[model samples]
Target chain A: MAATYELIYWPGAPGRGEHIRLALEEAGASYSDTARLDAQKCADIVWAQMSDNNLGDKNTSPPYAPPILKDGDLLISQTPNILMYLGQRLGLVPSTPEENDIYKINALVLTALDGLSNEVHDCHHPIAKELYYEEQKTEALRRSKEFIKTRLPKFLAYFEKVLKGEASGNGPWLYGGTFTYADLVLFQICLFQPQTDSQNLASSVYRKRDGVREKS
Target chain B: MAATYELIYWPGAPGRGEHIRLALEEAGASYSDTARLDAQKCADIVWAQMSDNNLGDKNTSPPYAPPILKDGDLLISQTPNILMYLGQRLGLVPSTPEENDIYKINALVLTALDGLSNEVHDCHHPIAKELYYEEQKTEALRRSKEFIKTRLPKFLAYFEKVLKGEASGNGPWLYGGTFTYADLVLFQICLFQPQTDSQNLASSVYRKRDGVREKS
Candidate 1:
């Protein structure tokens, strides 16, 4: 049987792929993890897919990096875009355009990806992605402190508010009454070891969410 | 007459709003820039909108930051999300789902925003967004070096390759043979001072693209 999705990312690290993984798990979509199967070959495929001379005319534009998803003829990247596409396909998002919940849910997903995940990555590589985390540890300390003290709390609190808002309908979900890809993404971010009292509080709330806790 | 769009972003710096602004310019869409009217009041509005108690029950979720767009009762944020919504309404994207160009264009737009804009912002705020540039200048210099020497070249060359791809159709647009929100976004990013040879080449190529140059 053919796989419903093929996820490519750097092996051994959940990183951004965790978000995609959670969505697939929640949707019960059958998928393949390329990196887990063969890390070396997966790296080669990612390199080639990003190169100017990719295998075929499958994609109009090549992705800049990994966390690429292959669904038959379609090969796409960008975490938010991938999740949005997959969310719609897997019924993780509302089917009706009129529902309007999908767009707002996507905005929340983008915030999680951009504000939470990306900034967390920057804490380790504050100077540059190419630089070793050890080389940038001093900068990383400062960044991580700010992230723990301010940025993390700010985003987590905002999400807490979203969970409590009228639009949430009940507890925990970022929008509507059901579990969304946004919730999945946020749950993954909150899983990182809590560095402060606020983050610990946020993680406990995340743990209490039925939808978020179910897959975890 | 009612405004078709209302853009809320910080005054003075174009920042990410420039991408949306370019799309609006190319589409000839009438829009309002709130910060331009009254910076202080506009900021207050943004603050309130971000808070748990926003003005109304219109938005399903309030944006974490500005660069929010208001259209009728809908409030949306995230640069790519707003642009995609506008691109569809403005006919900037190929309307037919059969075209399959929208997804590719959106992927390209996401690349430009995430890799280019986000990294550029990191150059100044290497440690933390809350910290002043002066506070982070040393780390900023290290990041700027990596950005100028490596990251910028990689993204520009990737776009340069995209422009020259079979999908680009003889010239500069990233997709579908005409100006797209992706092209508008790439063109805007290139408008920044060219800090490296790759960027200079990319900017010059962007300048020569007829579709991109028309509105300029």
Candidate 2:
């Protein structure tokens, strides 16, 4: 029997886990989405499997957080890592060396999306998650502004180059002629900005500067 | 003519950039390490070229940050992205579907390293980089403790599975036999922790862990 894929991620917010869901959805793969496993249940599993004292005769793999994928006996974690694993299985990645590099680039784009998510989380919790976003609103605003002015443009321009580069051939997608995981992630980034008040800031920069278009 | 790999990173601290450097060194590739490019130099060449306003007609890929790899017409960024690119080129990665998944797993390990680095940076500037470490010392202490107790084991156990799992039999390296960029990154992570204060805390929780012996 073929290995079944089990995706474990938080229930709501469609955050990082959404990227994996998008890929699986696009591929029409037969997978189980266990949305929002009880936080305590998840924490208990993590502690039982990952605790230092429990290291005897156990499976050894370091998964920092969820959005992990289990295919038969193979359990993998990390967002881009999981995506890359799925990209290959789903034919989302290319075949040849040159084409494979494009897939690698797409994975990097997804990794950047992860970085952006971290930044967003930080915006509301600049001090610490231990404290409420209300406690850090002033600091969050300052940091958010810097992120808008500096970081957002830096990341956006990077993708624009991928879109316009020779590899893309003036194509709409970041890779070859077809859309890949990179496109999914780019779409997600654009979708997420509005929730964080970064949409307006990005639009102003992208608009004032002609030649770049929002496709998806 | 072969294109020399040009790497741009901050001058002194290895930080994120070191992972790229280690891969290049292990591959025995000829490359230039350009560091300490201040705001002016960054503007004159790095930032200007990467910016949309200055991209002009150049067909090169844009890099989001330092440790970018410039190979002929191709310019790649993000540490794990660069390593994945180099891993294939240098034959550090295997050439089978299963092996390729292992390579992807190795890249994921690097991603974990990146996350750990972020946490370490937060230890000093927990609230925000805008504030001094002294201001957020209390919060940093709490966050750092959580990281040591919970995060370290979670990450290490994942690696232990990859190491012990019968992907290629219980072997030394991450992908079984070969020493890929992942191993280099794993080594770097171990080295970096001591430089920061994380070593002392992580040791108590993760010192006797399995599969960690290979890393040692």
Candidate 3:
């Protein structure tokens, strides 16, 4: 029997998990999502499967975290890897080596989105998640400021270059000719709320000043 | 004229860049590494090529960071993408879909290495690099402890399953028979000081704990 595609992710926070959801939704693949309230519940399920100690089962890989995709006996995790798997499976990626190069470029941009997410998460919990955000407000402010000024522009510009460099010369989308998982992640990251008014202003100002902009 | 592979990375920090270097070395591909003493020197060279106003050669796509690989006319970034690209080119990845599925599994493990690197960096600078580690000592300690106790085991256990689950019954390596880039990254991550210490204890403890465990 063919295994069904089951996706396990956090139900509440739409963070990294959205990447997997978007890919599956776009592919129109049949899959189930197990979103628990907390990490404990998620970890419990993962630990239980890993405890099985059976090496032969095709789908029994232990997931390190949520946003794992299970196909019958095959368990796979990692957002980029899941996207790449589905991209190829669903024909979202390109066929030729040259075309696949573009797919890779798009994939790379999506990884940058992960970096951006890390920065965003760090803002609220600059010191550590173990410590409350309130306790690290001052440090968070500085970190958020640096992220807005330096990191955000660098990432956005790279995507803009990708957009401009597309051989197809189309409007919007990273690959230009096709809509890949990269575009979805780009849209998601660009839409995330900035930590402060000034951070938001900085981003907008740079976009406008540079004359290469995306509408939020 | 063919464009030679030119890799630009910080000379001292064999951090993320080492992954690319190792893949290229393993493939025996001809390449050059342009490293700098400090971030300032590195930025100068990167920005010089990146300056939009210059636009000397429109054919070249500028990469946003180091470990960028230029093959012929193509310039690629992001470590895993580069590895995947090389995997296909060097015949390290399997040609068939079933084989590709295994390749994807290995790629996900490499991506996890990237995640682990970020956590390691965070341990040293938990409160943002803008603040000195001296200021965030308490937070760093807490995060580092959590990483050692929780994250390391989860990642290692996943890889162990991948190794054990190999259909060919391979020894040590994650995939069937050969050492993919995934193995290189895994080996690198395992060598990290903290992980090395914990891994020793894990092997001893889990050896005893394995028999009693049950499936989820």
In candidate 3, position B165 carries an lDDT of: 65
For every candidate, give the share of true A-B contacts it also has.
Answer: 0.51, 0.15, 0.21
Candidate 1 local lDDT, B1-216, one digit each (tens): 887899988777888888778788777889988768677887787787787665235346667787888987888888899988888888887655444566677888898887778888889888888889999899899889888887887787777777677666656567766767777787777665544455675753556444466766
Tens digits of per-residue lDDT for model 3, B105-190: 45455556655677778778765655678977876886677776776666656555655664423434455545556655665655
The residue ranges of model 2 lying beyond 4 angstroms of the native Cα positions read A1-4, A36-62, A91-97, A127-150, A153-172, A192-216, B1-4, B36-45, B54-60, B91-98, B101-104, B124-178, B192-216
- Per-residue lDDT tens digits for candidate 3, residues A1-216, read 442687777666777788777677776777766664367786566556445364544423345455677766566766776776777776665444355455454445545665566677877776555667787787678667767666666556555554555332342544535555566566566654443554443343234323222322
Candidate 3 DockQ, CA atoms: 0.27
Whole-model Cα lDDT of every candidate shown, in order = 0.76, 0.60, 0.59
- Residue A170 of model 2 has an lDDT of 58
DockQ of each: 0.57, 0.26, 0.27
Give the better candidate number (2 or 3) by DockQ. Answer: 3
Q: Model 2, range A47-152, lDDT digits (tens) per residue? A: 5544444422233344546667778767776677777778777877555436445534544565566456677677777655566778767767866776776666
Candidate 3: list runs displaced more than 4 Å: A1-4, A27-29, A36-61, A71-74, A91-97, A124-150, A160-170, A192-216, B1-4, B36-44, B49-61, B91-97, B129-142, B157-170, B192-197, B202-216
TM-score of each: 0.93, 0.72, 0.74
lDDT of 1 by residue, A140-201 (tens): 99889888887988887777766666676555566766666777887787666544566664
* Error at B31, model 3, angstroms: 2.0
